[model samples]
Target: MSDERRLDVLRAIVQDYVSTSEPVGSKALLERHHLGVSAATVRNDMAALEDEGLIAAPHTSAGRIPTDAGYRLFVDKLSQIKPLTRAERSAIETFLSQSVDLDDVVTRTVRLLSSLTGQVAVMQYPSLNAATVRHVELVSLAADRLMLVVILSTGQVEQRILELGSPTHLDDEAAVAQLRSRVNELSVGRRRAEAAVALVAAVAELEAPPGDAQGQSRAAVLRAVAGVLAEQREDRVVLAGTANLARSSNDFPLTLSPVLQALEEHVVLLRLLASMDGESRESVAVRIGAENPISDLASTSVVTASYTAGGVAGLGVLGPTRMNYPSTMAAVRAVARYVTEILNQ
Candidate 1:
């Protein structure tokens, strides 16, 4: 069989199987797709595809289904990612634009992706380690207590309260203002690591005289601020649409218990997302069945893309391997782009 004709036959089979969730025979292929070839030619192409391990007969059925390898080839070389419709684009923009905070953005995004693809959606919180310091505020709660609020470029806010051992000069308005100004001067516009280093150096420079409690208190506050920035390096993930998995339970040959167990393990999902980072926002990574590192996910597929939100993070959907590749890829890429835009704005 000619290579183009053979690939056309394989594409037809894959499309048919994805739509009907059943094995595809030559007669169905001819009936559905105008291959412009004889039935004998189609049968020969199916035989060659089966011989090449691209298609297989599950059970004793005469029809054929695409293997994992076949799916990989279809995605990598044959499939054209479908563009999102105008309604989809408008829905994404309107839904994501209404988000009031980082938490809300992630929540709405997960829900949107799940709704778009009818699969479980996962997203990583933007990494604070990669975000620059936008501002810092020091509020005096008492003579020896202050609330430190650290704001990041990604719109995340962290607060820490510090209690000095003894009553200090923090109550003096001018002294408190001076210390807050100096901390911001040294830390603002730098990343977490860079801000921590700058704050530490400032602390070292604030060595006090014998009874200069003002300098001592100032130095202690700087040290505490540095500690807060240094300790926020952990990344978090959010998920939605787990019930969608139950809706497609038949897609999994085994029980759905293992898949649910894997999803419950956030560390596993985090590691998987971290490993699947794409080269850019436009690059959508697809890990088909058996290609996923997690054994529980071996029968599933993950479609992910990286987005920048003051930092790089991942978002994607997980579903059975028999998913519609073009539509899923389009939704994942479009949502990721819109998210990046909203965040950067």
Candidate 2:
């Protein structure tokens, strides 16, 4: 038989194994698929496929199952990503459109992906570098204390409170207006490097010909701005669907828990996403069992792709090895596309 026919039989075996969670035999392959081959011919093809290390028989009496290599070939060569059904699309749309806050959107996104795929879902919240400052307000709380409230386009709010060395005793209204103007001039849409320079320049421009008391207060405010912006490197990772792993056919202790453990570590998770690097936004990467160096992640497979907004790209989803690759990939791609749209909006 041809190589294409051999791969076809291999794909058939993987599908059967994934669905039934059983070892697939040649007789079963021929019976279930119209490969136009007899059982003996199918057995010969299975043997050849085994020699190539794509599929293996578990024991002398048992049937065959695809190896990690087999799964990779199936994903890279055979499986066509299944598009979301209209019902599934509608469900996702309704779930996301109802979110009122960033926390709600992320929480609902995790739950939605899990329910749809029956696998653990991992989502990285939008990074600060990609978000523009929507507004900044200064609220005075004490004789020498002020609170800086920062609102971003991504719907996250951050506050930095400054306690001056001594009270400036300026009119509250005037001080707030000056501070707001200073903040807007300094820390807008520019990322860290540009923002830091802008901040230093803004503070310098506001410093001179001012009282020593007010200078101390302004210095405190600038220090507060520096501190908050220093934490820009911190990124958020949101996880859900871990409970769904209990439903996977893979043996729990041997397969699931380690994968779960790996998912729990931000460094490991970030490393996993890093392994899938590329500039092509349209490509979908499939890392099958054993392809990931983390032994705990070996039994698991991950399908990852990147999404961009405001020229910044972030990854979405770390799915299972036995994942319905076709549908899950489609879901990731579609969601990434829509998420970019939403972010742009």
Candidate 3:
């Protein structure tokens, strides 16, 4: 048999089984598809595919179903992810554009992906490690108190309220404005890692006119700016459509309870996304059953794509091994692209 014909049979079996949840036979494959082969010819091809371990006969008289290896091949080698229809694209823009902030975008993305794919959705919060300083704002509330806000290109906001060591020194509005300007100048284009170090030197070089008051004021204001910009960032993820998992509860041989447990653990989901981050944006990362390192998720398949707005993050779907790879991949890719566009905006 030709390799092309054999793969065609495997594709037909996978599609039929995925749709009907029933073992596929030569007769049904011929009936539903234009394979241009006789029933006997298809049956012979099925036997060849089964021998290759790509498709398996579930029972003595049953037709064949794609094994995990089969599904993986079908996803990696045979499938062309269907493109989203015009209506689907419009829905994505409408749903995501309603977001008010970074948190809102990530939150709505999970819901949108889950609804689109009919599976659990996972969206990793954008990594701020590569983020550049976007803006810095300072507000003085009291002689000794001021609020410093640090905004990053990734849309992460950090605030540090400073109780000035010498309140009277930083009390002047002009001093605060000068300090804010210097901080933004030094930190705005620098990466998060470089901002803290650069801001400190910029403060020290400030040419304050001689006097205890002016000197003390410069020192106090600069200290507040540096303090607020220096801090560690933690990576986070948001998930939605977990209830969708319950719909496929019976699909798990051991039970979906463990899968649900895995979702609740953020570390588990983060690591899962990290594993998939290496793939280029043009192709979706698909981790099939047993391919997942987590034993609880061994029965599930994860499809993810890394997104870059300010930095690299991840978004994808989690579904049963029997998922419709083509359509699900399309939904994930479309949503991840829209999310990246939204983040960059």
| Residue 217 shift from truth in candidate 2, angstroms | 4.4
Model 1 residue 37 distance off true place after TM-score fit, in angstroms: 0.9
Whole-model lDDT, model 1: 0.89
The candidate 1 region of ten consecutive residues with least summed lDDT is 274-283
TM-score of predicted model 2?
0.88
**What lDDT would each prediction earn against the true structure?**
0.89, 0.71, 0.84
Segments of candidate 2 deviating more than 4 angstroms: 78-80, 129-132, 168-175, 210-220, 249-257, 277-280, 309-320
TM-scores, each model vs. reference: 0.95, 0.88, 0.93
lDDT tens per residue, model 1, 113-223: 999999999999998889999999998889878889988988888888877766657887788888889989998999988998999988877979968888888888888
Once model 3 is optimally superposed onto the true structure by TM-score, how far is the C-alpha of residue 65 displaced, in angstroms? 1.2
Task: Give me the candidate number with maximum TM-score.
Answer: 1
Clashes of each: 0, 2, 0
lDDT of 2 by residue, 207-301 (tens): 65655656656756766675666565556767887777777745333556677778779778766665674622567777787787677887787
Query: Global lDDT for candidate 2?
Result: 0.71
